[model samples]
Target: MRRLSETEVRAAVRGGVSRDGEISRPLENDATAIKCFGCGQMEYRAREVCRCGYYLRGQLEAERQRNADDYLSRERNRFNQLRKRRNISLVAFILALFLGGLYVTGNLTMIGDTLARYAFLVSVVFVFGSLKIIRELERQMVELSKRLN
Candidate 1:
């Protein structure tokens, strides 16, 4: 079989009729064209596969599935990491609350009054910061889960 010249290929892509005089089906508006994924060349959409042997339907679907699987795996890892961090932050927030409560109730009396007050204030700040971080991480995990679904 003779290979088509570039001009001939372009003409066929542009809806030129074959020897049988049958008009090619247009892929887009008024143009019957397909771009080859392997070599980045134009071809008629009626062809089953590109000249470079990239099966249009099957290989394209496989590629899309691979991409989706990769994306989901990355997102799942990220979600797991976020869950771990959120658990850590929850533990920190609880510890900060416990220490702050002890200081406030005078149960931790070894420290000076001013130092205890400062420590309690610092613990309060830590608790709020941890809460903010946990909230943000939870929001992110929720968004990731939605995407995964």
Candidate 2:
């Protein structure tokens, strides 16, 4: 309901005659006037819903449901992306471990060059892939904390 100042309420209480000789009754606070969320325009508020032309019947409930659905869809997409990144990081890290073990245990005179080359490639992949995963995880953590607050 609209909250009118005391002055406006008093003025309305004192009825007046318009130029057309029509009597004006005092206005009631039954429905409030508010700005529409979708269009940012003024409209009457009824039953906790804005009577803006943009929405249909039961508009407020529909809008809330729509927002909830959108949030769920976005969260699912984010989880899928994170899963892919995690898998890539895990594989690269495992390869790095295997290559490092071979380098440390293999006989230098027998497979030194081959082990060294594979070790370098593994280290490069492991470092870059892990970094990417770490960055994405940190970003997601920040977003989660923000939503919590």
Candidate 3:
């Protein structure tokens, strides 16, 4: 199949309907239509704006913003959530490093050795947990990038 011309592709993404041998993307109330990230189709659905898995997630955020006032309140909530996750992973990595150091010290009694082992275990858990969060953030970043395109 022939590749769609740039004009045709742009039209299609803008949610154009074909007519008179030309595709035209329509906007509501004659408003300028924003490009959709998902399916390259322009849609008014705030949730439909993203072409990525996070489109609905963006919608949810929009909803939250619409209902809320006060930048401090909104930013605080966002920062707290981000910080909590970051701290979890940070603590885990630090614990792991500390345990590794203890193991290297090689001066532990039986109980100390057991404690070090447990610390190491906890560290492993945190590392895995941090990785999970990173993966999620990566997914979101990718979706945002599509919008930029």
Candidate 4:
């Protein structure tokens, strides 16, 4: 059986509609009135089983568990992506540092002085860019960790 939407469920509890698309006798609006998730039938909240033998409590618990599982999987995927990006940024930062150091010490002599200066400038830019990316990824990971906890 198809599940009812929230509005439809409320209407069902209010005796607004029936499965045959006919107006049913309106039920008294009480705190205990609720619609069953299994058969989409009006039922009392205090009752555990509906007329169709569907256990409301069990269905509710199962739905909650499914939602929690989905949330955890999504968060885990996001965390893994962030970790990969952070790792790539860290590697880039280290490489840029090494290149900049080589240029500064004049250890890379095959390149002309002007080319070496340009290379150093590019490496400096890469270093700062990588640092910024790493910081942002760290912040995101921290936020994900907080949410998970």
Rank list by lDDT: 4, 1, 2, 3
Worst 10 residues of 3 by lDDT: 17-26
TM-score of each: 0.65, 0.47, 0.34, 0.69
**Model 3 residue pairs with clashes:** 13-40, 16-24, 37-51, 38-50, 38-51
Q: All candidates: CA RMSD in angstroms? A: 7.7, 10.5, 13.9, 7.5
Q: What ranges in model 1 sit over 4 Å off?
A: 1-48, 52-54
lDDT of 4 by residue, 8-68 (tens): 7778766655544433322335445566777777766667787788887776577679999
lDDT of the candidates, in the order given = 0.78, 0.58, 0.57, 0.81
Best by TM-score: 4
Candidate 2 similarity to native, TM-score: 0.47
Query: How many collisions between residues are there in candidate 2?
Result: 1
Clash count for each candidate, listed in order shown: 0, 1, 5, 0
Is candidate 2 or 3 superior in lDDT? 2
* Candidate 3 ranges with C-alpha deviation above 4 Å: 1-76, 107-112, 134-149
Whose TM-score is higher: candidate 3's or candidate 4's? 4
In model 1, the worst 10-residue window by lDDT is 19-28
lDDT of 4: 0.81
Residues 92-129, candidate 3, lDDT per residue (tens digit)? 66666666566567643345767867766666676677
